[model samples]
Target chain A: MTQRPSDTQPQGEGNGSKVNRRGFLKTVAATAGVSCLPILQTDANAFSLDAFLQKHFYEMSKEELERVIERLENEYKKTYNKKEFRVGVDPPLAGVRFAYALNLAKCIGCRRCAKACVKENNQHRGSEERGDQIEYIRVLEMKKGSLDLEKSNHYYDHPVPDKDSYYMPVQCHHCNAAPCTKVCPVEATWQEADGIVVVDYNWCIGCRYCEAACPYWARRFNFSKPRIPDEEVNTNTHYLGNRPREKGVMEKCTFCIQRTRKGLNPACLEICPTGSRKFGNILDPQSEIRYIIENKRVFILKEELGTDPSFYYFFD
Target chain B: MGPALYFLVSAGLVFASGPGRGEVKTVERRSVLEDQHGYYPCSDCHADQETNPKPRFLQEEHDSPLEWEDEAGNTHLVEFGEKLAIGDLLGHGGQTGNRRRNLVKVGARLDVAQYMEEQGLSESDSVYVLTHGGANLWCLDCHNADDRDYLRKLNGEKLSFDDSEYLCGQCHGPIFIDWEHGVHGRTNGYWNRELDQKDVTRRLLCIQCHIPHAPRFRGVVPEAKPVPRLDPVSEPTAESHGHERHRGEYDRLGPHPWVETASTGHAEEPAHDGEKH
Candidate 1:
């Protein structure tokens, strides 16, 4: 709203117009309100008007994105009490289409990758008092002779490679034809140029449509405000990847977007003691993923559903 | 040609045709001996020791003595060679089997003259009979007898311990191909070399995962399992309880004191609005 000083002015400035007390008060009030506008825009929680009115990641201009990043960095630094916190927006590299491969014969069902995922991303550490546990990778122990997922056990706690069973770890596949993206009412989640399906936490409307639509059950809804220990928080976060998520929003694996964009492998891949996980740009003919897809007996989960996931599982 | 010469020629041929045939080498490998081997640079212990070239059961340096219980309920210290024979008889599949395979495969080439003499057996005895070819591998088949420091290839070419993969590839041809293609072994660091020049990709050497004597990977106790997702009832059962004791009180609480104070410092200010309006 423009200042009402002009409307209050009875005459021109040089003609001695500001004689009335009421008009003076009005002008002073208007100027004071305008001066306090910025203070009122932000609250005690650091939930700023800028963040509330922030545009979609794709729609934001370079300058706007920079300002948003700065605001997020400040917010996260304050929340986590970290001296070095960064919110990176590194985009997809040229001629790179990311793909992942897992050697079924090699995975030992150690769940080290799952633990590493929780630490790398700032997922909620669950407890009896506050029950919001979230992990990206779920290693399923399947029977030796069956491909039936329903028969697989997720809670086997013993030395792995049970003589009669095999382990199959399932996670967000980042499908080429992602069903989660299609079901997002607010278009908050979508597949990126590099074949990673990312969710804009700010844009999600907490509708849970995408969670229901996902065939792999890859999507996770934050039932309560995510509770991450300040010390355990991963300060090196990406805007759309492992950044702290809010209550009621959806989040999933972005293949460690913060790390991968800078040429580092995903946290799970690095922590796999079995060396079963392999990831690389499928577009690169010399890449490991390409070699696997070309030579190994690779297969995608639920291929008949036609999700066409970039992730592949192969036997030795 | 003799069996040794034929084996050498075939091993050389395989090395020539193995992976990394034409590709620009990008995978940086760590030195296997320095990183994994506890007792390396054999010269450290064998510098003044006499070299015994005979093919016989190792009774001293290489022997890992095992405790054995005889039929009379008496315990005895059994050497690795005797243990290997016992394990082979019992059809065991772990360390014992691995050692037996390695020793038997190597012993196939050497004359085993000392072994035959100790057992009081002739060349015609089935127990002491030696088979030729790739199956009969011995310690000197890989290790150089003249020089204790270097390993010798099948073709009698000396190789440093760092180049042990070349020797391993002679028999494990297919696995070596997979390892070179970056599919079988563990590789850490940058997946995309073009993006970051400083973070060089390091692939784990074969010896890093498998012991030279016992190549089989023994079963490991895995990390803890995930918390089961079930409805919370009035009473919490053992099945429903998570690893709560492992976590600290700070993790279960609301916003931490420092964060709470930093974000909500203005909340402490008195409410003057009640009288102002």
Candidate 2:
């Protein structure tokens, strides 16, 4: 029966200050209110109060989501100096769970997918001044004989399929039991019914806890305001996917949720010259992913962690 | 009222019976022959001339190799002009001496193995090999001798250029099967079959990616490296992160040491014990 120091302290007498629960709560409320005052005041402009108080994606009604999309579209149009901007909110289709299979043998260490991802996702294009570049995919050039990730080079600059090396492009695996989602303090990130793990950009508090928790180095933080050029900004955006993210929010691969939800192949898959990247609905019996899993030498990145990633790497 | 009801029922039945679930609908694809610029419609060149179905070394348009020198003072050679289905040798048999001599010529380049061995270069040093089935095939083997435009199957069925997958599938059965299932090759457009309203889902034809004469994918300069992050995070030291978890895992889970054999779809045993776990 040890009394804690806080319980033993005389509330009104300590240091000539009367600090009780009520006082502490009042202080907290005032701080929160003051912090949110800017967002509250900027209702008419880009930072709308409604946007700040926007509910989680799943909780939002159809009408509410529509309104949010309209607001975002307007905001993006002004910010990116575009005539028209679309914010798609397509829900996951029935009996469809998206999965990706990359042919490791076919991947020639070409970063076409990475570049295409940046362009399609509206990520910050780093300049000399800003010094912040965000890429969703990292193609690791590993020696043919080794599986040591430490020995793998992320920044190999040469004509690829380099003598004794093989390329392995790693991205957000969108795990069934995602560590990133579990550690999300604000419940901003979660796995969709279609197995695509997404983050609500507006709801994220930039804690970076999810980033640290991710084993695949999937989560990327916007350390500064994303500096996308007006011309380069991708107008087609999704709320829980690749809508141009604000500063401090965590962003990763959403399986191109904006595109995938509409039954279109992801930008990376489309741009791959080598036909290395494969994507399909795993639930469907006729899907290429199922074929690869069944026939090819398929393996997940970190099977021991029990992440059960929808992404599979295979060899022909 | 009876006649009107009967007519409506008949119309509904007709619409319902248009295409059954199992009915095979031919996907309308752009003609591969028409897509080939400058060198399609083999009949254009062969129609007026007499057909010589002899297997001989190409001495004309198809034989000219485009040669150039790079900034590094190294010579680079590229086979230019129309790629015929013909190989170095005409057919199998009666060319044993020639085959033994030309065996050193892997792909388009002659004496490559000898050159590599003399230079003490590894197999990877060579950029690419450009032969189809080790020059074992003749033009008439796949290409129809009767009709220059149509490809010939083993059963002598004439196939259009667009249906070259069927021709390729004759020899590369496993890969063809994988391609048909959308596993081996690139698939563009809609991933969902049901929602493919515009018929955007297009599996690339064999000839689209691979030249009939040289099927091996050539290595090329990759895209630019990602801009390095400004504030570099300290990497985890090798000692702290020992390879205990991945020590034996590489052998079992790393790229399998299976040799690709065309005859049987299954992977053959590992070439040597060094590659095995």
lDDT of 1 by residue, A92-133 (tens): 876678899999989988899989999999997776554468
DockQ of each: 0.20, 0.24
- Candidate 1 residue-wise lDDT, B167-269, digit = tens: 8898889889998888888887778765557746678777666645445565677776665444232332233223222223434464343332336644354
Q: Which residue runs of candidate 1 sit more than 4 Å off their true CA positions?
A: A1-41, A44-46, A128-131, B1-24, B33-40, B47-137, B232-277
Q: How well does each candidate superpose onto the true structure, as a TM-score?
A: 0.71, 0.73
Clashing pairs in 2: none
Model 1 chain A weakest 10-residue run by lDDT: A38-47
Residue-level lDDT tens digits of model 2 in B18-86: 211110123344565544455667787887767676433332454344443432355544342223223
